[model samples]
Target: MARPGPRDGALRPARRRTVELVLVLTALGAFALCLAMAGLQIDGRVPERFPLYVGVVSAAALGLHVTLRLVAPWADPLPLPLATLLNGVGLTVIWGLHHVRGTDTNEADRQLAWTVIGTVLCCAVLLVVRRPQRLQRYPYLAAAGGLVLILLPMLPVIGIEVFGARRWIGIGDFTVQPSEFASILLIVFLAAYLGLKREVLGTAARQLRLGRVKIFSLPRMRDLGPMTAAWGVAILLLVGTRDLGTSLVLFSVFLAMLYTATGRKSWVGIGLAMFSVGATAAYLMFWHVRQRVAIWLDPFGPDVYTEHGGSYQLVQGLFALADGGLFGTGFGQGRASEIFASDSDLILISIGEKLGLTGLVAVILSLLLLAERGFRIALGSRDVFTKLMLTGFAFLLAFQVFVVLGGVTRLIPLTGLTTPFLAAGGSSLIANWIGLGLWLRVSDSARRPAVLPLPTPAEHATVTMRLSGAHTRAAENGRNGEVSSNTRATPQG
Candidate 1:
C-alpha cells in the first residue's frame, strides 16, 4: 500500500468551530437550567421573565460566538464557553438574590445591561486586535496609559469614594473602576518590556558564595531599577486609593511576568519580601489596613462584628456558607442577601450558600480550565511578547480568584476584589471580557498552521530542464561507455 503524502496530512478537518458551537450550546443550556431552577425555588414555578432573560442571554452568547467564528476561527474554544457559563450563572444568582430579598434596587437589571455591554466590548476588542503582537509596538504608550488610568480615580472632581476606597470615577450616575482596565494595559507594557529585557534581568550580576559554594545569583542594583520603580508605583497606588486588591493584583501580575520572562527565582523572593514589608508597614500605619486585619482575625467577636464598618458582612457570609453543607440550601432558598454587598464583594459566599461545596468546586474548576487554556496558549506561542502577555493574564486571573475566594473563606483579609465573571460589576465584567478576547486572538495565532511558499514557475522549469539534461547525459554515457569527459558534468550548478 502507498503511504499518504504531506498534502493528505494537511487536509485534516478544522473542527474547532464545530466544537466551540457545541460547547456554547451546552453552556447556554446550563445557564437556562440555573435560571429555571432559581425560578422554581423562588416562586414554585418558572418565572414569567425566564424566557425573556434566556432569550437575551442566548442572543448575546450566539453573537459573541459568531464573532469568534468570523474573526478567530482557530482560537481555543473553551475560554468563551467557560466565560459564558460563568457569566450566565452569575446573572442567575443575582436575579435569584434580588427577587428573593425583595430589594428595591435593580442590581440584577444593571448586571444584565453590563453583561450586554461587556459582550459588545469583547467583540469590539476582537475586531480591533487582529494580531496580538501588534500591541508590542507601544510598550511605553501602554505603560503611560495604564498609569494614567490607575491614577484617574484620584482626581478630586471625578473621584468617588465608596466604602472608604477611592477607586471609582463617577460619570453621570455611572461609576467606572479605572484600575480594572489599567491592569490589562499594565500587563501589556510589562510583557513587551520584559520580553525585550529578559536577558539582562536574567543575568547574575553578583553571586553569593559560602565556603566556595555558590548560594544564589542576584541581579545588579542597577538592573533592579525597573522592579523597584514598579514596587514604588504599586505602593503609591495602594496608598493613594487605599485599594489593596488592585495593588496586590497589579504587583502580583508584574512579578509573575518578570519571573516568567527571566526565569529567575530571585525576583520572586525579592518581590515577596518587598510585599511582606510593605504590608506590615501598611498594617501598622493605616487604620483601614489594621481594621481589615482585625476583621480577618476576629470576625465573630461582638465588638468587631458590631463596630461601625465592621465585620458584619464577613460574619454573615461565614454563617451563610456554614448553613450550606455538602449540597447547599439550593438556588433562591438561602438568605445570602443578609450580607451587604452579597452580589458584588460577597458573590462567592452567595454561590456557596446556594450551590454548596459541590457547585463551588465546579465553578472553581471551570476557572482553572480557563487559566489552563491560557497557559497552553502561552506555551504554544512563538513570540516572546505573546508568551509573556498570556502568562501575565493567566496569573492575573488566578491571583484575582485566589484573593476573592480566600477573603470569602477567611483565608485572607478582604481585599474588595470582585470575582471575575461571577461578581456584579460593570468595569470588571467589561475588562475581563476584553482580556478574554485578547486570549482568543493569541490562541488563534498559536494554533494557526504555517503557510509554505510555493515554488515559482521559473524555478520549476529550471528543475525540469536539469532533470532532462541528466537523463540525456545518462543515456549518452550508456551508449558511449561513459566517455563524457568533454561535457564537463554540465557544471552541476
Candidate 2:
C-alpha cells in the first residue's frame, strides 16, 4: 500500500465559529429589542440605561465568542447564544419589575455585574480545563468537594436561612448558594465514576425470562452501592437543609445520569421508588415539605393562603398568569411584581405575566434547544467519559428546567431552585455559565479531529521499500500471466 501524503488524516478547522458569531449577533439584537420594549411599555420610553445594558451584553457576548474561537473553535455554538438571550430576558424582567414595584432594587445592575462575572468564569473554565479527561483522575476528590459544598449551608456562622431554607451561606455581605456549584461537581464525580465502572454497573446478573425470550434485565444487589449513596446524599439534602429544589435537582440528575451510564431501566425505577420514599418521609417528618405540598394542593384555601408563608405568593403568581392570558400584557405592563419572589422563585410566572404563553414557550424552547445541543455533542463524542459528562450536564439543565416549571405550574410542590440563566441569583448564574464552559471544553475535545503523527524518516523509508517490493512482485506476476496467456492461446487451436 502507498504511504499516505501529508494531507491525509490532517485536522481541518470546522470554523463553525463564524456561524456562532452570526447567531450571537442575532440574539443580541433580539435582546436589545426586548429591553427597549420592556422600558417603553412601562416608563413610556426606552430604559435610561438602555445603551449601557446593550453595550454590556454585547461586550460580554462577543467576548465569549472570541474566547470560543481562540480556545474551543469546534465547540457547539447554540448554548452561548441561548444563554445570552435568557440572561438578557432575566435582566429585562428584573429591571422592568423594579419600576413596577416602585422600589430601589439595584437588581439589574447587580445582575449585569454577575453576568460579567459569570462570563469571565466561563472563559476561565474554557481556558483552564483544556482536557476534560484529566477530570476522570480525581473523582473522589470531586465527590468530596461536592459533599462539602452541599453541606456548607448547614454550618453555623457562614450559613444563612432564607425563606425557611438553609441553602445559602454568607461571607459578610456576599451570600452564595453552594449547592448550585456543588451540583456540577457531583455530576462530574458521577460521570467519572460511572464511566469507569459502567461495565460492572450496567451488567445485569439476573434476567426475567419468558420461555425462549429474555424479557428484562435487573440490577445486581451489590451494584446498588453507588445508587444508594446518591439516594443518601439526596435524602440528606432534603431533610438537612429543607431545600427541596436542590435535593430534587441533585438526585434526579443523578438518577438520569445513572440510567444513561448504565442503560438500565431498573435503576431508574429503583431511583424513582427511593425518591418517593424519601419525599414521603420528608413530608411526614418536615413541616416545610408538608407546607409546600399543602400550598401546591390548595393555594386558594383561606386556611392556606391567609397563613404566613402560605400560598399567597402562589395565588398571586396564578393571578398574574391569568391576567396575561394567551397573549401577554406586554413587557413591563403586568402585575407580576406583586407576587413574592417574582424575580427568582416565581420567575416563570413573571415571564408568563409579561410575555404570556407564547413568550414563555419561546423561552422554554430555547432551553430545550440548548439541552438538545448538549445531547448532540454527547452523541458526537468518542470517549465514554466525555459522553457521560456531557450527558450529565445536559440532564442537569433539562431536569432543572422541568423542576422549576413543574413547581410554578403546581404540577409539583414548589421548591427554591432558580431558573438557570433566567433567575436573579448570582451563584446560580455563575455556576450554570461555568457548566456551559465545561460543555464547550469537552465538546472541543470531542469534535476536534484527531491527528495521527507522521512516521519518522526510517519508518517512511521502510514503508516505501515495502511498497516498492510489492510493486516489483506484482510486475513479475503480470509478466508471467502475459507469457502464460500467449503460450496457452496456441494450444487452444
Candidate 3:
C-alpha cells in the first residue's frame, strides 16, 4: 500500500469533523435561502451577487471547521456551527436592510469583510495559544491592556462621539468600539486572579454575626481588592463614558465569574447592590442616563418621541416587532431600513421584525445554546483558571445578549451594545471571535485523551537495566518463557 501524504492526513474527516461539516452546510443553506427570500420579497428577484454571499458564508464556515480540526481537534463541534448560523442570520438581515433602502451594497460587504477578519483572528488565536493555562501568568498585563482599551475612547483627539456616548475611537475613516475587546481582556484578568484566590475567598472568610443570629461570612478586605477594582471599573465606565451597557455587562460578568469561583451566592447579591448604587448615581448625575430610563419607561410619549435623539428608534423598532408577530413580515417585506441604528443595538429588533417572534425565539435559543456549551466546556476543564476563563466568556456573552434583547423588547432600559456574532461592528466581531477561539482551546484541552508521559532519562536507564537483565537470564537459561513477568520490562518507543 502507498503511504498517506501529510495533506491527506490533515484533511482526514473524523467523526466530529464530519458532524461539523454537515452543520456548517446546513447553516449556509439556511442563509442562502433567507438571502433569496429577501431578494424576491423586495426587488422581485434574486439578490445581486447572490452566489458571492453564499460563497463567503461557506468559505468562512468551512475555514473555521478546518482550523478547528487541525488545531483543536478535540473541541466541541457545536459552537462553530451555532455561531455560524447566528452570523448568517445577521448577514441576511443586513442584506435585507440594504436592499430595502436601495443603498449601495458596501455596508453588508463591509460586514462580510469584518466577518472574514474576525475568523482569521480567531484562527490565529487557536494557532498561538496551545496551552491556555499559561495565560494565568499575565493577569496584570491583561488588566493593563484591558484598561487601556476601555479608556482610549475617552481621549480627546481619538475619541468619536456617536450621539452622546463616547465609547468609540477613530482610526482614519473607521471607528472601533474599544469596550468590546476590553471586556474580554478584563475577563482574562478576572479568571487568572480568581483562580488563584478562589479557595481563600470561598472557604477562608470570617463569619459575621448579628448578635445571636449568624450573618454571612465577610471576605477579608485585602481579598476584596479585585472586587473593588471591578466595581470601580464599572463605575468609571458609567460615569466617564456614559456607557451603561458596557458598564453593566463588564460588572455583571465579573460578578458571575466571582460567584462561580467562590460558590458564594451572596456575592451576586452584593455585586448587584453595588451596581444599583452606581446606576442610580449615574441616573441622577447624567442627563443621557436619565433620558434612556425615561424612554424605556414610556417610549411612545409625545415629548420624548419628538425630542431629538430620543425614543424614535425604540418606538419604530417596537412597531416593527408588532408587525412581525407570529411569523415575520417575511424577509424584506417590512421597513427595517427605516429604523435608526438597526444594525447594532437594534439588530434583535431587525430579527423580530422580519423573522417574527418565532425566528426571534430561535435566535435567542441559539444564544442560550452557545452559552450552555461554553459553561459545559468550563465544567469539563480540570484547571481552575480554565474553568473561570471559559465561564467568563460564556457569561459575558449571555449577559450581553440579555441586555441587548431586553433593551429592544422594552424589558430594560436601552443602551449601546452590539450583538455578538450577529451585529455589524468589526471590533465586537473580532473580539468575540477571539473569545470563541479561547473557548475552543480550553475545550480541546478538556476533551483530549489523557496521555501518560514517557519515562525520564533516569527512569529509562533503570528500566533498560531491568530489561537487559531479564533478557540475559532468559537467553543464558534458554528459557524465555520462564522469565518472571514482573522482572520483564518493555520500553516504549
Candidate 4:
C-alpha cells in the first residue's frame, strides 16, 4: 500500500485553526488596549515606569503562548490566551490606579513580576498534569490540604489581617492568600467526590410517608455532605471574618458545579436552603452583614447610612457607575482610582467610570465568552473526570463574575473579593493562570486523537475472515436466488 502523504497528516480541520487564531488575536488586542489605557492614564503623572513593565509582561505572556503552541498544539484553544489578555488588562488598570494615587510603582512592578512567575507556574501545571485520571488517586489528601490552607490565615500571628478578614498569609516580602489556592484544591476534591457519587445521587428512595405522599430519600445527601461542610466554612468566614460576599460566591460555585455534575434540582434546593440559613444567621450575628443588608435594601434612601457607616463604598461605586452613564468619560479620565484600594478590588467601577457602560458590558461579555468556552470544553470532553473538573473551574469563573459584577452594581451587597485575572492579586493571578492551563490541557485531550494498539495476527485473521465471509455471501447471493423475506426482514439496510 502507498503511504499516506505528509500533507494528509498535516491537514487539520479548519475549525480548530480558526478558533486558535481568533483567540490569539483577541488576546493580543485586549493586551494592547490595556497597555494603551495604562500609558494614557499615567501620562506625565508617573516616572515612565509602567511602559517597561507592560513591555516585559506582554513579552512573557506571548512567550508562554508560543511555548504552549509548540509543546501542546492541541491544547484548549481559549483559556490561556484569554487569561493572558485579562491579566494584562488587570496590570494596566493597577498601574493606572497607582499613577492616579501618586503611590510608589513598586506594587505594580511586583504584580508584573508575579504575572511572569504565574505564567511559568501555568506552564509547569500543563507539563505536570499529563493525564486527568491522575488527580482521582488523592482526593482526601487534596481536600485536607485545601482545608489546611483555609485555616492557615487563622494560625497564631503569622497570618495577616486585612479589611477585617484573615484571608492572607504574609510570607517574607510577598503576601499570599491561601484561600485562593485552597479553592482550587477544594474544587478538585468536589469533582472527584461528586463524580463518584453521581450514580448514588441519581438513585432515589422513599424517606418518609405523609398521606399519599412519601418523601424521597435525599440520595444526594451523600454528595451534599462535603458541600455542607464547605458552606459551614463559608458561613464562618462571613460571620466571624466578615467576608460575606466571598462566602456567598463560594456557595454558588459549589451549587453550580453540583448542578452540572448530576443535573439535579434537589441539589439546587438544598443549596438555596443552606444559603438562606447562612444569610439569616449572618444578618443576626454580624454587624457588617446587617449593615450590608441595610444598604442593599435601601441604597438610595434618604440618609441610608450615617456618613461613613455602611453605604459609603456602595454610594461611591454607584456614583462612579452613574457618572459613566452611557458612553463614559473616556479611558484614564475617571475618578474611580482616586478612591482607596480602587485598583485591586473595585477595579470594575473604575473601568466603568472611565470606559462607560460600553466598556463594562464589553468586560462582562468577554467573561461570559470565557465561561461559555470553558463549559464547552467540559461538555466536549469524553473523560468523566476531565468533564467534571473543567465544569467546576467554569463554575468558579461564572460565580466569581456574578459576585463581583453584582456587588459593583449594588445588585447584591458589595464584597471585598477581587475579580479573577482582571483584579490585582498575586494569589488570584497565580491560581487563575494555573486553572486556565488545566483547562487547556483538558481541551487538548478533547480534540486530540487516541492511539490504538496495533492488531495481532489473530485479530487480523478475524478481520480477514469477516471481510471474506461478506464477499462470499454477496457472491453466493449473486449466483443463487434474489433477496428473500428473511433478507428483507434484516435490519442492516
Question: Lowest-lDDT window of 10 residues in candidate 1?
Answer: 4-13
Flag regions of model 4 displaced more than 4 Å: 1-9, 13-22, 41-47, 207-228, 236-240, 300-309, 456-493
Per-residue lDDT of candidate 1, residues 40-142 (tens digit): 9878998777887788878888999899878877789899899999999998888888888886437877888888988898889889998889999999999
Candidate RMSDs in order: 4.7, 3.6, 7.0, 6.5
Q: For model 1, what is the C-alpha lDDT against the true structure?
A: 0.87
Tens digit per residue, CA lDDT, model 2, 15-75: 4788788889999998999999987898889988999999998999999999998888878
Residue 282's lDDT in candidate 2: 87
C-alpha local distance difference test of each model: 0.87, 0.87, 0.86, 0.75
Estimate TM-scores for all models: 0.92, 0.91, 0.90, 0.84
Clashes of each: 0, 0, 0, 0
Q: Which run of 10 residues does model 3 get worst, by summed lDDT?
A: 1-10
What lDDT score goes with residue 136 in model 3?
A: 95
The digit string of per-residue lDDT tens for model 3 on 1-493 reads 2343334343334777888889888988888888888889888899887988889878987998899888888788899989888988998898788777878878789889888988888899999999999999999999999999999988999988776789999999999988888888888899999999888877636667799787776776677777777788899887778888888888888888999999986677778888999999998998888999999998888878963478988888888999999999977577678888787779999999898999999999999999999999999999999999999999988988988988988999998788889988788888888899999889888877665566788988999999999999878776645565534665657
- TM-score of model 2 (CA atoms): 0.91
* TM-score head-to-head 2 vs 4, winner: 2
Worst 10-residue lDDT window for candidate 4 reads: 1-10
> Clashes in model 1: which pairs?
none
